[model samples]
Target: IDVGLQTKSNIGKQEAADRAVVNLETRYQIMNMVKDFVRNPANKNQMIPFDADSTSASASIKAYNELVAERIKLGSSAKDNNQALQALDTQIAAMHNNVVSGVENAMRAMRIQINQVNQMSANAGSAMSAIPTEEREARALYRQQGIQNTLYTFLLQKREENALVLAATTPKGKIVDHAYAQSHPIKPKPMMVLFLALVMGLLLPLLLLSVKKLLTTKFSTQDELAEIIQAPVIGEICHNRHKSQLVVKPGKTSSIVELFRLVRNNLQFLLTNDGDKVLLVTSSVSGEGKSFVSANLAASFALLDKKVALVGMDIRSPRLAEMLELQSLPGVTAYLAKPGMNLSDIVQSSAEVSGLDVFVAGAVPPNPSELLLSSRVNDFIDQLRAHYDMIVIDSAPIAMVSDTFSLAKFSDAVLFVTRANYTKRNLMNYLNTVMSRGQLKNVSVVVNDTNPNVSTGYGYGYGEE
Candidate 1:
């Protein structure tokens, strides 16, 4: 309502200014008409607006018409003086047409302006009507013509008052305005926009990382897997183990064979056909499936028709060579103590798997770590490698004794058996320190007793991604 009222007031001022313009135009036209009327010698001294009353012309025309009607009613012979009658009729017609036409035209023009005034009044809208304006030169001319001086004096005063008012109401020529006051700005509040964008840019990456951590159940990196195992992760096989096979055969599968193939692949890559051919297999504590991996890794290579010998290298506790009911023989400890002992004398063949061989850790060594670390043990490994295409050497765990580290340097690769939620972190830290010092160049870590439901656990499925 306030805005409406303000707009109305401004419009009122504008209308008054417009009306003043029209009044000035009309006054000019009126002066022109008066001048034209007086320029004729006959009308120069004789004509006065007060003398030439338009209302009087109209009344005379009406009265003459009434008399003409009465005369016609009195006689058809009223035209006895034809010349005078004709002259009277002609003068009446001219007076009547000119007076009525002039007054009607003026009134019609006035009505156009009156319609606008009426509309503005109905709305109580902003507008005003200014008094008719006169030219200064015209007013001076009127004074020179000896007309009443009071009228000109009054018009002059009114003109001067209005000029002062208009000057006051209009803005100063140099009034300050916003540079874009005439149009809208395109880069409004640009600094604020940039600040907001910068904030979001920093936050989005953190938001995505948080969301990823929340949704995934499986471990993605070696570090995470190591954390779960509570053991040092000696190494990693980047690709999935299950997808690859030792050799392709249709519609047949061996879970044991496949796992061993992975172990063998890692072994061959790390071990590089070097020391530790006569290996041992044992866990920190039992039920870790150390026997399973040792047994299968031997057969996985044997399936290629290669002579792969699986030796029960764990001397303190021995079960690998006995699982299949093989005859007991003086194996690793015997070979370690007597460098003269031959590899063929101790090895036995597996009836269950062809091309595969087994050997027991005949007698548990009193000092397995010291026995395995002997110079004679190094000779034993070199002797076995000459006869077999592959040799899977399973060793005693570092968690049980430091013996594994002694054997680690001699072996082509060290495959650490880690049970989920079994091995402690501090023990593994010691083992890791040993490996990092290049004690075992080809070392790999495998997770056992792993929960398959965990995305990063064993039995993880994969293709090319």
Candidate 2:
């Protein structure tokens, strides 16, 4: 509605400008015509001497009257005598006729000249007379134009004033009073929004928790582990903030260390003969604490006075050497690449745990799968088995690489590590596949990085006893 009003105002102003332009043009034309008429040479003939012509004719008639009076006196004086009087009368008559003829001729010429002058005066007067009518018409037109200009100017001014008023004020609208909260908010209801957010903050976690419990198949507790896999969970390692891979120490009494002790003790039940058990530790994916569990489990076994060898079989990306702070060179890749390389030359002792030994992945090779499949690797494992009581091999993620499958063949058992809330449930399909194919033997899951909130259901706690 305001737009329509503004449009109308603008149109009116445009029409005003157009009318002003036309009025100015007409005024210019009228002024030009008046100026041309005033400057015209023919109109100057209105000053013609018609009165002077009449005065000249009157002077000639007076002179003729004086001559006639003179002739009449001569005739009157000679009329008493006989022949002389008659002759004098004839002479006077002749003179009188001559004077009369000259006068008449002069008067005729004056009349002709006066008539011509009068006609010229009349023509000039007629032209001049038309001027007043033209002037009146021009004035009337000018007055009309002025009036129109004034009207248009007034209209334009009013429009401008209206526009300014519209620009300065808000539009009128129907008003009604309604109930509102006291103390109108300046920036919005920040406190109210915060309270609502706090409520959602309290409820959102419970909602997500319920959804996770209903929709997910991933195990979060020991009961879930026992129910799904139908196997004993050797250990449940809590989440650790340690930067190193080997979390277990000989004298450390941390919950993680105690958990590893429990796992080492429970691992004995899974062994049939316990003659140098070769355990392969791997996960379906990386970052599930597979390497952490392998190194710590070895450290735990070493604390048990059993000679333990922790081998980094994941040549693709080795972290055990760096995690244990040992030299990565002269290890598995080098031992396997060189013909007749002794296992003792590659094996390095761990300084943290007295009985723990570590073999790094050594230099990265292009084909880790092929290297692990080589006959030399089997011989290397066998030699390590003869030397160490427990050979815990930290292999590559089974889901990502085939290195673990090759290394798993000579192992006595495989401990699959899965992190709670980290490892996906679909990995179970891959584990079941490997088990069904006979590629894995005596496979057990070690649920690593379990949340304490979830472990509470299984009565697991890390508090000091």
- For lDDT, the strongest prediction is 2
Candidate 1 residues 1-465, lDDT tens each? 576677558556545544543443344344344334434456421211311123543354344444444333333444546765566556544644554455445545545665665455435332222222353345336433433343355456656754554444343345377554546566657888899889989998899988976765545445655664433454322232453222212222433334445556655555445444544443455655576667766776777778887767677777676565777776767877776777777888877677887777888877777787678877766766777877777666656666666766555555666555555445556556765677655556665544434434333343222
lDDT of 2 at 252: 73
lDDT of 1 at 434: 60
Instruction: Tell me the tens digit of each residue's lDDT in model 2 across 1-465.
Output: 575566455444434544444444433333333334324566321111111112433353344334434444444444556675566445544543443344344445545554554455444344344344675466447646775676466456646754543343333443588777756766657998899899999999999999987799677766566655633577798778666667788667767778888888888778778473999899988898888899899999998898999899889988888877889898899999998778778889888889888899999998777787788987887788778889899999989988888877788888899888777777877788888888888888888888755584233455532
* Top candidate, metric TM-score: 2
Candidate 2: residue 400 lDDT (0-100): 92
Task: List per-prediction Cα lDDT, in the order shown.
Answer: 0.55, 0.69
Q: Flag regions of model 2 displaced more than 4 Å.
A: 1-211, 217-219, 274-276, 456-465
Candidate 2 worst ten-residue window by lDDT = 44-53
Candidate 1: which stretches are off by over 4 Å?
A: 1-223, 226-256, 271-287, 338-340, 455-465
What is candidate 2's TM-score against the reference? 0.53
